[model samples]
Target: MPIDHKQPYDESNIFARILRGELPAKTVFESEHALAFHDISPAAAVHVLVIPKGAYVSWDDFSANASDAEIAGFVRAVGETARIVGAEPGGYRLLANTGKRAGQEVPHLHVHLFGGQPLGPMLAR
Candidate 1:
């Protein structure tokens, strides 16, 4: 499934619900610009998600609409979350799936922090 970047942001999306406090999340970090939480279906031992508070559907949307401060803050939050989760030092992978073809299930723009074990190759043969 390929994501249509032109489509409007879905407020009904699960991440949006979590941001609105309508859904529960195991939050790890929160700031004025971003929120970090554990992924319900983690792919790695330490899988966490860092998302901006603003309504942005993808990386393109975020880079285009979000302010510089928002971008910086969000990235910083991701790093901080990685450190808190013990994904730093040893190593970690920060990933953002822009479209459905990239396996982006949620519409909201988010960064996934994966670590705690060797991630291996980025893609399979």
Candidate 2:
């Protein structure tokens, strides 16, 4: 189920577990402030998730609390992850579900990078 974006960050969240090396993830890229990995259930031909290293519950929380360096690093990491997934050549889309209403499943803030084929409309009408 989706969760409230304002909910407290769960240390044992799946992503956190993956970060702590207590769970396995198909990692694609890693930097000081972020980690990019293949989504277990990909939504497109190329699907990867990039998340900041900080304990942020949502974009609102992240923007309010993360250091400038952390912000820049996470942004760069997402871009690099897109490149690593070979999506730059074909174009790509970045999606972040901020709250339960937006379909956010994990409490941790994460961006989904999607590409490898035409993604069609930005939103289904």
Candidate 3:
């Protein structure tokens, strides 16, 4: 099954529902620009998803032409979410997968924070 990045937020996606407060999420942190929550399908012991609240589909939607405030908010939200998720003190990894080829099951622009347990090669270049 191919993940469609074009249809990032068509309202049917789980993250969309979460953003709209239509679905229940273990919310870690939230600001005007972003929301952070626990991943229902967690890869690590502590997996948090930090996402912007705008209509931007993916990281491309953000990095390509987001405002300075948007970019700053994104970075700050990711850091705040990491701290809230206990990732700051213990250390964590922030990941944003762009397209289908990168294993981005969801199209929304989100940063995944994983930690609590030792995270090796989680972001190996």
**What's the TM-score of each model vs. the native?**
0.95, 0.97, 0.87
Question: What does candidate 1's lDDT look like per residue over 1-125, in tens digits?
Answer: 55665589999998899999999999999999999999999999999999999999999899999999999999899989999999898899999988867877788999999999999998877
Stretches > 4 Å off in candidate 1: none
Model 1 lowest lDDT segment of ten: 1-10
Mark the 10 consecutive residues where model 3 has the least summed lDDT: 1-10
lDDT values for all models: 0.92, 0.94, 0.81
Instruction: Judge candidate 2 at residue 71 and give its lDDT.
Output: 99
Candidate with top lDDT is: 2
Per-residue lDDT tens digits for candidate 2, residues 14-98, read 9999999999999999999999999999989999999999999899999999999999999999999988878998899999999
Q: Where does candidate 3 stray beyond 4 Å?
A: 6-9, 122-125
Candidate 2 ranges with C-alpha deviation above 4 Å: none
Question: Candidate 1 at residue 20, lDDT?
Answer: 98
